[model samples]
Target: MIDLLEIPGFVLDDEREELLAELRAIPGTAATVLSQDMGGRVQPNVRKTTRLAVSPETRERVKEWLMDAKDVLAARFGVALGDCEDPQFLRYEEGDFFVPHQDGNTPLVHDASRFRRVSTVIFLNERSGEPRQGAYGGGPLVLHGHYRTHPGLRVEAPADPGTLVAFRSETTHEVTPVTHGVRYTIACFFRAADAP
Candidate 1:
């Protein structure tokens, strides 16, 4: 049961396009290659996308939005989350996808990797209210619930521009392959302020 709150008009149309242009200039290999949480290795199979450096002005806006939504998130996820990591902007072109995985912990990996309390993905692209109007095809954020207990339950969060979806980091989720246009997004990971 993931409570995905759709945030309309979070990023204005102009701003989104500006950010997209900045990402397009970077070479895929350099911008997209990032270390995985499991083994600290750069892997594209598990997660593939380029990281966009967010400007300070944009960061301030996001931080304010997060603070304003704290209560809603806390009530929905049943946890007091604080301190969000600097979000990474990601661009997913045709055939790109992220395999199902949890963001919280990975067996023996210590350090700051254990603090991911909440996971967030903010979509950036004009999305028509109609399903067919989606600029890009596929790339739905599929949340895999407990199969046995929550039997046959799955939540699909479409990548619509200006939409924000947040969930517990422990939940298993994946980004389905994009069949059409490129998909742009920002990944935000939050940690509990008081965690050890």
Candidate 2:
């Protein structure tokens, strides 16, 4: 079974808190999915979350941090990675979720996403089974094993604050519905250095 690379404390406590504060202060727009025909479109059934419009300064800072993970991800996944795309600051409240889907490099898509080789998610808060301060309930990130090799295998990613989970862009995964509190994360994609 393929396992996800989990880097604990990928974001330090101070940095995470600062990021959270900045994100909370800004308004958000509905997150969208990339469509093969029309590009990105809001499809609530497939994904339900808010995409924060972070300041350019924040975006650059986050991109730099995400870029720092490229070498590690490339070595772990045995893939050559080039640039890290602008990270998306996402917020998931109660009832929010993303159904099982691949991030990129699939025949179903013919957009810029096709160049994605690695996908990353940085958790900003802890997850609890029940309501608790600075924690969210449910919203487990479930990573599925390749169908041909380990069908039915599902791994729930760790929800520790500042943790980063990296996986192949083609891996099927989903975020289970959040039951309480709020879930915040930064999602980013990495492409090959030679990709057009």
lDDT of 2 by residue, 106-191 (tens): 88887888889999999998888889987899998999999899889999988799999999999999999999999999999999
Clashing pairs in 1: 32-50
Task: Give me the displacement of residue 16 in model 2, in angstroms.
Answer: 0.5
Number of backbone collisions per candidate: 1, 0
The worst-scoring run of ten residues by lDDT in candidate 2 lies at: 32-41
RMSD, model 2, all Cα superposed? 1.7
Q: All predictions: root-mean-square deviation over Cα?
A: 3.7, 1.7
> What is residue 28's positional error in candidate 2, in angstroms?
0.3
Which candidate number has the best TM-score?
Answer: 2
Q: 75-187 in candidate 1: lDDT tens per residue? A: 78788877777676777777888888777744554656577778878788753323454366777888887656674678897556777788887777888888777777887
Local distance difference test, each candidate: 0.70, 0.90
lDDT, candidate 2, at 187: 94
